[model samples]
Target: MKTKISTLLLLPFFALLMLTSCQQEVVDITPPADSEALSASSPLTALMSSASKMDGSKDNIIDNASCLSIELPVTVVVNGLEIIIDSEEDYKVIEAIFNEFEEDDDYLEIIFPITIITAEHDDIVINNADELKEFVDECKGENENDDDIECIDFKYPISFSVYDVNFQVIDVITVENDRQLYKFLKRVKNSEFLASLNFPVTMVLADGTEVVVNNNEELENTINEAKDACDEDDDNDYGDDDFTKERLDEYLQICPWVVHEFKRNNQDNTVEYQSYALNFKEDGVVRMRARNGDILTGTWSTRVTKRGALLKLEFDTLADFTLEWIVYDIEYGKIKLYEEGGNRIIMKKNCDVVIDITKERIENYLQECLWRVARLQVDDVHNEKDYIGTPLKFFANNVVKIRLNGEFVTGEYEIGVRNSGFFLQIFLQDRPNLKLEWLITFLEPGLIKLENENNRMVLRRHCADGDDDINYIDDVLLTWEWEVALYQDGDVNKTEEFFMYTIDFLENGWIKVTDPNNGIIDGNWLAYRHEGLHLGLHFGIEAPFDDLNHRWKIAEITQSRIELKDLNANGEIERILVLEKKE
Candidate 1:
């Protein structure tokens, strides 16, 4: 359905209402104790309030204000060139113009009458530079400590339950964004009404890790622990160029970084250094491994100056990567290094990358865990969907098996050394798309990237041997028979397609379906977690169940009911399926 099902959300209310038109029983929950309830003046409440404040430092190149942000689609003049700044990516254009010539003076003029969002999440209009400076003057001076917290944030759509003096539920207010949460917390701070936050709230840390807190105490602790855990990038620079020397050095030494992009003196050299890995060791020693198993030694050092962090590499043979580059962007598991002469390198960290690949190492990693076909493109056609719910297992003696419909399909695989590189060959009958001698381009402990002439594939390792969550799901699904309670596809109701159908989930990953006419159909089913939990189903070309052959996200699950949703590219629900246990 195109219509989105919004979470139960309510605007902040000023007055409590008495039941008059309808009689609905309100569950009586005791009012939170003074210490348990969110108090306006309490430290935890203050932290939450600060965390909800608008972070305006991301576009500091345009506003130069740490506590204020200029709304997008604003036009600005950069050195006599007028450009429409629509998104954050356009900020790099401005930075590039400013850094074009060091001898020339840089300037930026805003075509004003723009809206600015304050740290308090208030929208203000500024007509000229003078009017904008009024708010800019109030911001912290270039990365100085401020009242707003930026290292952790509350995952939105969280809600609070409003209560009356007698502790009876009066209303439930849902907050959809930071602005709404900030305004609502102000009421909580002023003691305008009695309210308590709903339990089991989720918070996201700066590094994109999610933490779920079930109670007030856990929430408080989670916030406190993550409040100061990351670099907020509060400076006026566009990216994280203000890293300390020690921090930058330690970060590089954590894992081996593979070059994803490379440019030297305005010439692209990505193909030559595509998979070249760099390992920064102690005592100024760095090792570089080439695709042909050649190891090159280099000296590396870092120094932080008033301008920014600089990384210098000295290699006798690898001259292209031997320049002193400015560290412009430091993100999780990635680093962006650039220099003035159009030299740049983008490296991504991979702790499991095998620098010295051998026949033994390749076979060991293949047999370690089950491999899921995460991506496959053959002859410009996407083919990964056909392999859903099927994971390949590698065994000893060149034996391979793919689980399909809870049964093992025999196959043969071989790892061979070629003049170009290591190649993986698969011989599976009736699977012509996967029967190519694919060159292994990238290899890591949990990942393998393979490429043929016009085909590419990625396999991600999946080890669920002892995962308690998967085990629990498997047990719950096998306990009883289930029937489709609802099936919605877009604006169409397709529940009757599987009328009187009974589904039995077997332990070996097969689903046994009995239709209304007593005809039996077998399908494959797998429960796994990637970003979130999902139920992968593959019914082949079965008449009615063919429409249900896709990986559905597990939205909710209980002992008797399971809710699954298929989301589109924008995360909107495209289809929903609900299965309830047979009574």
Candidate 2:
């Protein structure tokens, strides 16, 4: 008796949907006994409905967002049984699909195996006889590196009957014995469909002679010789590699290797190598491709040293290239070159291991590009681009830097893990009680989206023509009295005795105004937010000085000038104050 195994994914509208959006409702519907056209409107409505629940305030961007993201696990229903993908075989299939998506294609069609039942209902035609061994082998976990390391065999072989454009039965093949099973698995590469076991069952290979053999590895070894004969020339570039001299030779062969990442002298010099290439020939010659198309040739060789293997390159054009480094075990995805005194880089291979999406990763993702307010609705009012340039930046050591008006303001951030995954918890140093929590719903290349309990934010990587050189602002603000370019209403003139007080903004949200007059007035200051950021102070501070007590909105902060405004309920300005740095 042959078991029918087949399934068709009918997610018609959710093209890029994944596990993160599992809340996407699937309309209740049984598999059609005959056939019925399904509509996409139901699922789309559910998705839109789910989005409406978030707070519509985009201006409330605080540390309350998460960088957590999850991928969809393999799931498909077969022969009335739901199968959750838990083994490497399933992961391989999913990985194959992802790789295929990068290539140009109109649609994806997968080969399926099944048993065809006749209209008479009494008879079943089975066509998986030739495909059974491969399925059983895969279920036993072949070439598996991680979780699915155990061997498991199903009680019986499963297959699906092929269907044509008109849904007409095309073919069915079944395996009655071991010899046919061997032939099926041997020619698996040529076959369009690789077998995926439908129902979950566990056993050793021996169901007596019908079963190929007993014990998992023995069965795999018995058929591998035949499988290897067909796969000699077709293997993944890195799959067959072991960390040996031969592997290193293969890695450095003919192609121009671009230094994708770099570090030197306690500083990241990756920008120096972006447009250059380092080509190491087998004959000991290394050719360097300069940014201006100048060919700066160098000699390179690998030698055994007391530290380990050493990668030595000598280039006359660039003295920095003439250095030696001990080869640490190459990992973190790319070929890692490490030297003494904290210098190393992960080369061309796109292999950067991120365990928990660390602060550094977020900094790299955000700092590389400036992000503008894509959608900002605060108190049911949309916030236009009142600010300019890349306004926000995430830095290491749990810090967040933001540019308001022309000055740089910074705060703190943290990530927490719960039952599902990770979440973001953010609050400014000054406003500790105003904490924000957000579930990190999605992240991808060039885009990061955050949805809070009350707000939804979408920040596109800004591609404007400006360099990220906010360091100069830091230099000017290092120590300055808030004076010089003073503005009251529309007055862009100087203020008196602003120099008597040495102005200071502490990272912990403390603003100390100390002068001989009333001794000192300590106030809580908050910055780096979208909505009203306040400085709490109501003491001997006077008129123009009383302006500091209002709920202030940052207009611009730069190295030389600072602009602030008193905000009313509807975002109308009540007053404006400008101050220049006292050098």
Candidate 3:
């Protein structure tokens, strides 16, 4: 399953205030003769001459010629609402204010103050009888009551038929420079339907300012205009035709709640997750399903704004299992998506495991016996038959003892079929250099015969020599052999014999030996081999030396020592030597 998550964020509201003020200036007034004004018959001329005469007077004039500047507190109402105005000139100035109210009904309205002229100056000349009568009637009607009156009320219901309603064509305008466009759009009260749109919408103003409508309409307009004007050569290019709304309905059809599968190597574990919604409600609710038919229902919540129906989402993976959520803004033919956090899905496969086994634990089911020996001490007396039974007793205290420490010493043992073979590795602790030997008896060799013996303290395999057919043990062949050496007078050259032995079980269990030809040979012969050979060595008073004849005679066989060599041979030997009874 493929899953995609989404979220939405709301834009902030903008506030606007309109401030207006007025100033009054005084001027000298002069009066004109009544006969002269009557002959001229111009009401404006007669009024102006009368205003000039009263200009310097401290008393207020009452003639029709004087222009009285009256400061009246005026109020205009719209749709049963009223806003106060101070003077007639202020009211007239406000009369030019025209605005379009965005609504289903779409209407245009203007509100302003009303002004009236009354009789006042010394250039008093009511020249025309009709004009005098008209002025008198107006003054009477206006002064009839002190209460304010509604004068100009022209309602023009707007027709949206002039503008094309295309969801994919958006008009983008910058809020910073084009403040009038911002104010006009902000006044639109019926914009709730904008939340459901999935395409860019353009808004064109009377002042030729175009803006794209979305969740972040102001931001989108500003950014788009900035980007467009960055490389523009013409300064009059602030138009809406340049921007086209890119439809996103097709993309939004693929909802966020989709399923995905994840697998790991070297393991039988798999994970599946699904995303449910792109524009989630603040209540944190969503619907999801896994690939294994598992259904999960939850909520996604974020603080992002929705300009053109774009929302953002965020998830608490630790608290839940999801990663991150991001909301995109669709405006002015462009989609701006914001990425918030890191991706959380991961798969791990194929790993190696290691296990460690201690020496004490291996000795429990494997160790047979242990022994230690010091330098032999004998008295130089030929008639000492009592010395035979009184052999020097070696204390067992100095003997190296093998004790079990850990758990099982068993491991998976495998060998290929045919002449094929397998091997086991054993690691041992180091000890002071001493004459040691070992042997191994496989309880079950399965199909192959086991020929094992302790060759050298450090076990290794041998490659076939120049004569490959001479039965030379190949490195791949698992074979075991052993050898021994005796030292006299503690010196290698103290006049003694050295012997080396190789166990050849296939040839009749005959031990091949190499004797030292040097007259004063006393070097210790070391033999290392695998631990599968069950061989033992006898090391006691085996013979008496014939000093005159220079040949040793067999007197009596003493104690026989036996030990099991290392199985895996990893720099350590198994302490399985056995003590034998003297004959």
Candidate 4:
């Protein structure tokens, strides 16, 4: 019954292609020897090397390709699976459209294959003309239903010809600058008129000499001449690899290093993500082990930038280390990285722990951050609403502080084993006999679950500073639950059944009263300062609940208790009512 809901914090993948404008130089096909993965003679390599301002992202290619113009008898990799593309009409139509490349025509009128994903997470692959028609028909109908696109992963390294605004062939784009070519393709997807090209796309030789090709024939000749240079590109980074999990396990002689230092904005924060480690296998798989033994799997690769800087780690997806980090140095058991946002992290050997696994992990996790009780469960029934405003904290000295109800209760705790299982024993100063033994059920950086046989409590790491920043009036009221502890009209005592009814203030000048006898009653309530020393509430409701409908003056207010006096227009007290915030 103990469940933890985690909200993913994803670092967005983004990049900008920087362009440099200059006059054409003499052909220098002397293999720039720029990137480790790309050959020197590749035209893409030469053009990319010419960029004066290079960013971390455009330094490589990351894209979702849906459109492609595959050459007949060419091999295409779709989701890491390679297949041969024969002479097909749709491919031919796209090829013909490029053949008649006219810049002023406003658009290329491209009809390439779109990656169709069904609602059940299956791909719709069309092999022939009939299948293509069927797929399109199904797609048109799918618009009305939930069956839609999972993603549009474009067929990368698609042999496509680049044309300028004049409809004249500019260059043949291939896998050499696959990263830049991918960006251009993404831009073309949302584009209605691509008359103005975005990529500083000029075909060139290895020596930065611009290649001028007026027609598709010339561009083809140019690319063919650079074939040997282009062949050296590593398609592994292109996500077209045959490496499986078993293969990677057999391949890695050692795991990636652990993060020993984390600095944001140039400040050292080695203690933030305590006990962080990463395992980047040779097969491009990345695994992260961080606070409280939570393991996250992602993809990482190393590529040489055109500027000839240090080889940087390129990550696909992660919560913390989100962008391309420059590897300052990486050795057998140590690695240093610099993120684009001026944040840096260092890693060393990740060794095994000697303490009790659950205890040590949970203690370290708690010390690194503040937590709040999001839910409490007893016998599988959730009682989260009762402790709505409480926040918790754990220090390194085996001490814990819980802001319960309206008081801060400091407690002592111990991490030990009992009956072949792990237990967290919390001894509150006020309640010594009532031992709160919580079984260590679940633990993560931002979430944790502790359960006994019948009780479970789910705590969440605070995303921002605790709601303590909220001022007392409306903001504080919205954060906490106020309940009627006692109600009276100077003669009758209604405090006995106070648990059966509750009053909650609403933002829209309304009040919702939960009644055990009835169901729910909607009324109006307002609280404001009448005089410098007097706080007033205008409470109004219908029939049986009519006694609470009176202009009341607040005599005192505290974290747990509130005192109000029923008063007439003359400001004379008739009766007193008391309320307390639920713990």
Candidate 5:
């Protein structure tokens, strides 16, 4: 008996939320124009309400309802086989069972006493089939137009300022997800208070493109234009199993798909195949780029069957990917393919991935600028700390050098080609992490990703040669003798600890601190631009100064004074440090 298991919550309605209790934090508000506010009758409000509506079509296989979703963990009997569905992945199990026997009539029976969430996110308990059927009867026929706008979604935590009847700001509410947004909007729709969305709110289209709208007009126009941009997939099918062969083929060929997860015959091969890209061409041809910069050719085809959309790939050397895979789930920028016996492959579309990688191109990109060792993990041990303040420079003569503490350490580097792919080998004494024959897994204009058996390294290009900001920061630090003027550690006034300490920012990536008693403490410091301008300090357990060691955001900088602050994940200031030039 072939039956499919509904694995997990495929849509928002099935997912529950644990709403966080927020405290009222008063902030400065700049009220927008009347037209910029979100009112009950605004078209943008309607679009948002529609977009926030519960999409119940995802679990149609179990409930057969397009406006309601059965909350898990629901028990069901598929062809007399009792199965408990706890998550969305179980959907594949049920579908796999159904595809097992093509000739048998697949039937499913739901276990009673389950909860169903309605289109308005209301929960209703059903004890038996009669009660469930009555609610199901109220739902429109499959694929009919519904109140929910499935083609777009709001990227939370979007915030809105709630005002009193006079438009005086009262409260600011932050919504974490769709449910919370919908509930908040319901209050706004009822004219509870005048509310305006915070500017620069992000709206996600059906195809995963994010549009940031600054005001009400832009928000309204964006929602109206994207409401019907893509297929809503508001049918009874659990996945995109109803997609035609032509549609499936076209989707795969739109961009190169990079292997995110792979399992072959019950064995996890994700790391081995991760970042291996496959580009499906028009003429049944597919090109796979291996991690080592090697490209392999293969043949691909797709077909629609009673089971679902099927994608077949044939590659002589790539045996793991040579199978007829069932296209179980296809989402924005991603596709999930699986087969019986624990074989599955999850690929994500990457339009930026270059299929044709060459040695000259790699060398040219590396030589354009200095590369920072942004990330380094060898045998699960993070070693990037040792490479701090160090940047690698590549030259045309296969020569590479790392600037360590203001000194250049020369090394020989080579871009080697092999059957597996491209490999980068660097011969530098005392730097064992960079000595590995790393396979170049990913490469772009400003970034290079490399890995080996148990090591991974990510290098970000840093072209500081003509950067005005870097020059200004470097000149400011080197030209002045500074002292800790203010150090606020969570409201504590600890500035007096370093009353007479003089600081010198040396060009050799060293910070020399002289005490009032003529004692000196040496430390490492680097000023760089990432996300913003930052000053990285490392004192290595030196008293008082060690406490100031952190990658502090350069909040304010000038010839006389420099202010740096440590920010929390929410972009809130946690600590403040001020450095004033000594006369």
Candidate 6:
């Protein structure tokens, strides 16, 4: 079976549309202007009024309340023996008939006592009271003893009632048999009719067989043929087997037989069986092998309680037997078989079987494992500067080595200004060396090496302050000292004395004089001074010399001093006197 979960996703949309449509139609009705102006009655209204009056009346009036008595037809069949319905009447009428039959010799003797089963009212719809009354009158007859008979056997269950066109409640009739009557009375109470007359019908004889006729014409023809056959069988027994077989043959010739097909199977032997297609005569009773072979013939019995068909099987010869059969379209074509208190087998159409995962894909998935390794190295060097400045060396694609020494350090250099000068130093495995120093005044762009080694080097651009014509020298030069004396006595005492000194440079037209007794002085002081000289003196007690230029100025003066002349032009002096001090 196919099953699915269904959802009404659009139900609200349809409901809203229905609500809108219902709101558009409007109906209005106005009542008559006054109730007094309305007419009291009309012809159709009178007829309805009469119908209501008749509905309140009853037929059998016993005391103040009206009583109702009804007779019904009944038939009974027991084991294929049909008990036909002959006459119907109320309780009183049937009692009278039985009493009359007991006294009359023309009536047949009562072989079986009339058995009372049940009495009940039939369900009916009556439109008016007249129709109910008519139904009672026709079934009861006039004065309860009329010769008109209305009840007859029709071979099936039936009931009758009377009603008007409006389908209102009228009287009702009930026809039942012994089985139906027993079931009916067991469900009800206080039954009235004790018994009713029912006739036993005989089969009509044609040739030697029994036949059935439904109408009068056919019944009469069957009776005449039975009379003729009776005369020919004066010496034969009517219930003998030969007579029965002959009757069966004649019946088969006259009546057509219907055929139906039933298929079966034997599960153990794997065989199939089937019956000829036959018409449904009555409830078909049959037993067939599961392998499509007829095994037995009997009445097909049905279990009303279980709601399933039953089959009986018996083996004619002694052999181990197994039976398997399939009934189609029962409980939606699902066949379940049970044996020994458990389900033995089950068969169904359109089932699913499943298997999982393939092998090649699993093998391919297992082959995908990998391994890898990683290595690391680190170095410690004394010449970090050289190592950083040196060009990167590669011994091989994956290996590298760096070598450095004091003399030829395989390292790098740095070119930049330092404390003493603009310098370049090399980083090496040993101590690093300064490659070059350009004095502040002598900075230039060139290549330099550290410690006279070409292994560690640098190229740099240097700068300084001066005219471009300047040159620098590395000279170990000595400084000069000077002393001075000033005399306040004409005797030239050394007690009052002071000394001063200065230096000079001869290159690049620059000079610097450094002195402790005097402040720093720049420029060529030798060219500016006329009479003063840089001097050194010895302190002693002696007469001050009047020849000042001859004693000190001769050795201290590095350049010649210019002489001054007298402007008056006189050639000789009278007294040759000089300042000489007695000490």
Error of 3 at 16 (Å): 45
lDDT of 4 by residue, 120-143 (tens): 223344454454445334332211
Please give the RMSD to the true structure for each candidate, in Å.
11.8, 24.7, 38.9, 21.4, 13.5, 58.2
lDDT of 6: 0.24
Instruction: List the candidates ranked by TM-score, beginning with the highest.
Output: 1, 5, 4, 2, 3, 6
- Stretches off by above 4 angstroms in model 2 are 1-242, 303-310, 326-333, 349-583
Q: How do all models score by TM-score?
A: 0.62, 0.24, 0.14, 0.31, 0.58, 0.14
How well is each residue in 1-583 modelled by candidate 2, as lDDT tens digits?
Answer: 1111123222222232222234344333223222121112322112212211111111001101111001123243433334444432453343334323222332222123433221111123224434423322332122223211112222334332322223333333443322233333323323322232122222232222233443324333433322222111111111221234555665666355556766777677777765356667788888765433345778887765445567787888777667886555443344556776657655553222121344345556756654543454444544423222324555666676655423457777676655434455555554332244544443333555554545655555543233233333333444565552454543443355344654555433344566646456554333323333322222224434444554346577776786777666887776676657656
408-483, model 3: which lDDT tens digit per residue? 1222211212222222223224321222222211111111112223221211221113534223322211143333
User: Which 10 consecutive positions of candidate 5 have the poorest summed lDDT?
Assistant: 13-22
Candidate with maximal lDDT: 1
lDDT of 1 by residue, 32-69 (tens): 77766776677777888888888888889999998888
Q: In model 6, what lDDT does residue 562 have?
A: 18
The TM-score of candidate 1 is: 0.62
For model 2, the run of ten residues with the poorest summed lDDT: 60-69
Counted clashes in each candidate structure: 2, 24, 63, 7, 20, 30
- TM-score of the candidate numbered 6? 0.14
Question: Which regions of candidate 3 deviate over 4 angstroms?
Answer: 1-271, 274-283, 305-324, 328-341, 344-583
77-138 per-residue lDDT for model 5 (tens digits): 98789999987678766766775543468888999999998877777899999999999999
If both were scored by lDDT, which would come out higher, candidate 2 or candidate 4?
4
TM-score of 4: 0.31
Give the per-residue Cα lDDT of candidate 4 at 205: 47
lDDT of each: 0.84, 0.41, 0.24, 0.46, 0.81, 0.24
